[model samples]
Target chain A: MRKVAVIGAGMTLFRRRLLETGKEMCFQAVQMALEEAGLELKDVDAVVSGSAPDAFDGVHMKGEYLLDGAGGVRKPYMRVFTGGGTACFSPIAGWWHVASGLADVVLVVNEEKMSSITPHPQYAFANIWDPILDRPLKPNLVWIFAMEMNRYMTVYGIEKADIARVAVKNKRNAVDHPAAQLADPNITVDDVLNSEVMAWPVQRLDISPPSDGASALVLASEDVARQVSETPVWISGVGWCIDSTMWTNRDLSFPEYLARAAQQAYGMAKIENPRKEVDVVEPYDPFDYKELHHLEGLLLADKGEAPILTREGVTQRDGELPTCPSGGLMGVGNPIAATMGIKTGEIYWQLAGKAGRRQVPGSPQVGVCQAWGDLMQFSSVMVMRA
Target chain B: MVGEEYRRWEGDMEALYVYTAGVAGDRFFREIRDNERLMGTYCPECDVTYLPPRLYCETCFSELNEWEEIPNKGRVDAITVAYVDDKGERLARPKVLAMVRFLGANGGLIHVVDLPEEDVYRGMEVEVVYLPRGLRKGSFLDILHFKAI
Candidate 1:
């Protein structure tokens, strides 16, 4: 397989509402990516678009509708969906395009217009579960996360304050991030603990607000990458997996499916010990407990140990093994499918020494980004190196 | 200077589906209606009995026909006290919800339980209080609340 590298990355300001339509958002992100890569729209060979659930945007067959804005005019374009994992897996789809001699330069774009959904943005999430079994319960999305957090907490004897500290760190770290929507440097653990309890374990502050945003990356073959970028971040490994849709069947304390996905990526990267080898890490953090949950799933920390590392300030922007230095989905807006802004785009900035104030401590060499999706079933991981 | 108005289109489609109960669900619901006992599909390959049974085993995807009459009582895996409903309206009395796993069952049912907030804790056993046989509708709510045993 030929080597693939990320030549450029771009994102829109994640906001609760954007006047721009989904197509326009895609155009904005793709334009920035093309500009950064020094390539015109005509230079792109193929387009890989990622978005989740047409229900949110109220557009069925959304890919075809978004084609023109993605610069896929008269080009081979395909859409990918793996729930929230679409952000990270979209680039993986681009990697295969360049790696298999399919396309020289692939434009990977993701956009989520969550604000378009009427009522509360959280209402769209109600469809994520089984209508027959789960919908009968009249569940709001917060109940599921709260239940999972409660189970994980009970199993590990994890304190609520320890979990709240993750919210404190990521939202504070978001203060330096340009595209962050919920950045607040003054937020404390008490503030999180005392925040409105949407669900007992998951309070309003523990979760990321729904947002409208888009993110894009330019993936090119080895030759095209060298020409486009002086410091191309090489795609070392890509892995994705999905567990059972029957969420209640498995133990919710640990994300076993995510661990499997990471193992595949880590294996391909020849990374035997992620804790020692990976310098910067970005795990999907739609919720504060999720970052800690995924940290273990990625093998960066032992089971039930992510909270302890978090409490010790090891997960801060300038700490050892900085996780979600771009403020994560918690700090940045969580536009569901557009979270690649942190998972992939943030890693690119950190590796290229262009993350501005949110950059990691030292000369970082390797980073891993992952996302979870689809009713706690899907997981996607990418290992990148500078 | 005059401000130009932009159009914002908003319409909601009401989609309704006639979902088939399938082989397993059909049997599971029929038992609830005919007999007041809860049923489960036991996968012999895995030796695990699944509550809210499925036609195929989730682990091996093996076609499962073996059914068992699981006890109607189980311990709470988790409990939530909801202050509001789906419409974001506050309820007069907060609903107490629990995910109750029947004995030796791999999965459980999420239902509103009749238990006080202070008395509720993980692992507390609760029994399903089935609606009167006359009121049985073959739906999940046939069993009204899982009262404290």
Candidate 2:
């Protein structure tokens, strides 16, 4: 594979409610990313867009609906979705564009207008269940997550207090993120524990707020990258994996999907030990417990040991591992595909020494971004080095 | 750019989605309709058992042939009292959605909870509540919601 680099990144404010249409959000972010890359719409050779379910947007063939706004009007464009992993997968798609000599400049965009749906975005997920069997049970989306949290807590011997720490840390980190929607809150373990329970093991505070937003990143081949920017972040490796959709058949306490994906990325990146080799980590965290769950999956910590590292402050911003320095989807807000771009964008800034407040003390040399989704069936991982 | 008048679209669209019957979905609903407990199909080849049920073993590439019954009782994994519908419009009040995993099951299934919105939590015990025999529609809504056992 040829070398690929991120030339520029742009994103809209993550908000609970945005009057702008989904297309508008995409156009705005794409325009900004292109401008930052010192290019124009005409310079993009291919476009890749990703969003979760079209049910949330209430628009079918959403990729075709979003083509023009994503700058794919008459160019090569394709849409990819692996549930919530859509965002990270967008850039990985871009990576292959340059790697395969298909297109030199790829425009990657992701948008999720969860706010456009009514009643609850959770309701749209009702259809994601087995329509014949599980659907008849009248299961809501929260039930599966609740079951996973229960198993994680039981298997890891983690308490509600330990899970609360993630919410507190990520929210605190969001205070400095300009686009974060849930960035400010003086929350504690008691705060999370006392919040209303949406399910047995999940409280209101444990979940990230539904959001509407868009993000864009521009990727260029080695020659174009050098011409585009002085501080382009190099993409060393990209990998993605999918577990069986039969989620009930496997262990839910940890994400084996993420482990396989990470292994693929590490092999391509030629890293022996992820925990020791990678300088910064960003594991997808839509729920507080998920950060810990994915930490083990990413091999940042051994299975059943992530919670211990988290409790010891080893995964904190100033700690040994430094996970979710961008506040994650938990703190930064989750708008489906856009959440992963924030992780991608944050690594770009961190590797460039541009993260002002949430910056790791040391000048980070390597970083990893991971996203898990699709009823815990899909995982996407990318490794970047400065 | 075209004027607003020219930009308006006047047309119709039709789309369809096709899916295969996965591992446990068929038996899960069938057992529930028959008032029998249901779980997932476990493949000895991959050593993985599925919950919401499936048709094949993902790891071992074997056809799943067994439907294991698991206890209905399990701890809550996550919960939410969503105030808005799927369209993002605010409802008069919120409805509770919970992710619950059964004992010895690999994954949890989502369902509505009969418990008051305030009584839910991460580890609360809940049991499946089947719909009335006469009211069964063979759809996902057959079970109104799970309740605290």
Candidate 3:
């Protein structure tokens, strides 16, 4: 297989609302990434666009609309959506493009404009459920999360206070992230527990707010990567999986789908023990519990043992296995697929030791980033190294 | 480039989704109407009883035909006090929604719990409340919700 590396990464500030449209945001991120890679639109061989849920953007065929803005005009622009997992999947698609010797330079751009929707983005969430079985109930998005978190808490006997620590840690860690939306250094566990109960176990602070943002990555074959980037972050492995659509059929406490994806990625990366070999970590944390949930799924933590490690500072930014130094989705804002800014982009930055203030203390050699989407069905994982 | 106020328009999506009750779903509803009892699709292959019956097993692709009688009594797995509806509109009073997990059943029911918010804690025992036989429509709404026991 041909080698591929991330030569450039760039993103826009994540916020509840942005003046720029989705197309404009796409251009902003793509332009920045191209400038950083010292390349131009003419140099790109193919393009892959990742945006999720047209319901949130209030437009049909959103991919076709944003193609020109993403610098995919007249190029092989492929729009891929696996719900929120599209960010990682975007890079995975881009990697295979170069690895297959089909495209030397593949530009992958991701964007989400949840702000375009009315009253709340949660409205778009309603359409994701099964119309016959689950839609009649009219579930709020938070309820599903609350149900999962509550089940995890019940099975592991995890205290709410211990889970609150995740929110406190990620939001505080976001203080250094320039694109962060809710980076509050003063937040505490009490603040999280005492916050508004959107759902019983899910508090306001525990959940990431919907934001409008865009992110871009430039992928190149080994030869092009050497010419374009001095510190190229190589894509070591990629994996993704989807669970049964009948969400009620499986155990909600454990993300078996995500675990399967991680297993495949680990196998490809030849990583025997992720708990020790993985130098840095960034698992999708749209909710505080998700960080711990994905950690166990990645086999970085023992089953029902992640919360304990989290409380012990093992997952801190400067701790042994610094997790989500980008403040994650909770602090950095969750723009659906555009969260590549934290997942793919953050890992690249961390592997290159360019995460700035959020950077880990030592030189990190390996890192893993994962994303989850759909009705807790789809999961994607990508392992990268310097 | 976005100016202070760009030309914008508002429109509602014009899409309608129609769903059909599958094999087990149809049979389950009919049984609920006949006996006012909950049924689970028991996958003989995997020995897992799916609460909301499905024609096929999730683990094994084998078709399931066994029907297991689910105990109407269940403990609350989770509860949420929703103050708004699907449209993001605030309700006059918060509705207590609970995930009622029946014993020996693989999946549970998500419905309104006829209890106050403070009283609807997880692990609290609850029972299914069925509507009068004359008013039953042979549908999921047959069991209005779960009531705290």
Candidate 4:
């Protein structure tokens, strides 16, 4: 297979409600990415569109609805949905488009218009349960996540303040991100602890806000990337894994699927020691606690020890291993699939030395980004190098 | 061995969706409700006019900038008679639905036909019938139905 690299990336401002339609948002992001790569729609050979659920957009066949703006017209176009994992999985698909020699240049666009859902976007999760079992109980995402958080805290003897620190770090880091929606430079742990409680241990501040936005990336083969970009970030590794849908049957404290996915990516990237070899990390953090949980899953920290690392400033922007320096979903906004802008997109910028204010102190040469989705069962990992 | 405990379980799901007419859709629906006219977007690159006006052309991916009022007259491209409603309940009377295509348009609209099933033919010409302006809301409902012209 041929090597693939990210030549350009772009994202729209993360917001709760944007006046622009999904098609218009996609067009804006795609336009920015094409300009950044110094390429046009006519140069792209294939297009990959990613979105979370059709219910969020209130439109059936959403991919087809937003295709024209994504520059998929008269091209080999495909839509991929793996819940939130589409954030990274779409880029993985784009990688294959170039690696398989099917296309020399590929564009991946991910969009989510959660604001289109009335009442609350969480209402869309009500339909994602097992009709015969879970649906009868009327389980929403927060209620289940609360249960998982409680279990993790109970088993690990972790403190709420330790979990709250993740929120403080990410939100503070987001102050530098131009597209962030919830960036708070002065947010504190006490504020998080004092925030309104939605479920038992889950507070309003602990969760990321649902947002409407779109993100795009341009990927090209090694030779084409070298020709288009002076500092192309190579996609050296990709991995994805999904566990059983019966979430009740698994241990909530640790995500085994994420560990497996990360292992696959680390293996392909030939990094024997993630702690020492990886310079930067961006793990999905829809909830503050998830950042720590995903850190353990990615083997960046020992199981149940991520909170300790967070407290010691090991995960800070200038710490030994900076994590979520783009502010992540917690500090930024969670538009589900559109978070590709932060996860993969941020890593590309970091490795390319273009992160400006949010850039880690060290000139990071290798980075890893991961996204989790689908009833707490799906995870996708990607490793990139400058 | 079969057990009575393994029988079927029934459940109901509750989901609500509020759809926006979008940039192009708002303009199209507003024209029908306010002026009693049908509008379509023209794509010069593809030389095609799209009904239910879109923001971009599907064939060439060009941003559609030209807007034109399309004549309501069109021929029935396809017709279907429904005796049952969405919930599978028998309707008071059989309803006729037709896909009407306009001249110089790439896509068509599917709506209820005012004519009876016997009178609705595959190539019969029809025109849009709008509700009174006082009762019209900026929605597809503003166009009451299609009638034989």
- The most accurate candidate by DockQ is 4
TM-score of the B chain in model 2? 0.83
Model 4 alpha-carbon drift over 4 Å, by segment: A19-24, A58-69, B1-6, B121-125
DockQ for candidate 4, please give it: 0.38
TM-score of each: 0.73, 0.72, 0.73, 0.91
State candidate 3's DockQ.
Answer: 0.01
Candidate 1 C-alpha lDDT tens digits along B1-149: 25878654443334332233435676888899889888999889879897887655533334568999998779999989999999999998899999998888888998988867888889998998888999998888888988887
Chain A TM-score for each of the predictions: 0.99, 0.98, 0.99, 0.99
Across A128-222, the per-residue lDDT of candidate 3 in tens digits comes to 86665666676787888899999999998999988888899999999999999999989999999889988898888889999989999999999
What CAPRI class is candidate 2?
incorrect
lDDT score of residue A326 within candidate 1 = 88
Two-way TM-score contest, 1 vs 2, winner: 1
Task: Give me the candidate number with maximum lDDT.
Answer: 4
Candidate 1: segments with Cα more than 4 A from true spot: B1-149
Worst 10 residues of 1 chain A by lDDT: A120-129
Instruction: Report each candidate's C-alpha RMSD, comma-separated, in the order given.
Output: 23.3, 23.3, 23.8, 2.7
Task: Itemize residue pairs with steric clashes in candidate 3.
Answer: none
Q: Estimate the overall C-alpha local distance difference test score of candidate 2.
A: 0.82
Positional deviation of residue B64's Cα in model 3 after best superposition, in angstroms: 63
Task: State the lDDT of candidate 3 residue by residue for B30-111, as single tens digits.
Answer: 8888899999989876889988876555333345778989988999998789999999999998999999899999989999
- Please report how far candidate 3 places residue A277 from its true position, in Å: 0.3
True contacts kept of each: 0.00, 0.00, 0.00, 0.42
Model 3, position A311: C-alpha lDDT score: 93
Candidate 4 per-residue lDDT over residues A280-354, each given as its tens digit: 999999999999999999999998999999999999999999999999999889999999999999999999999
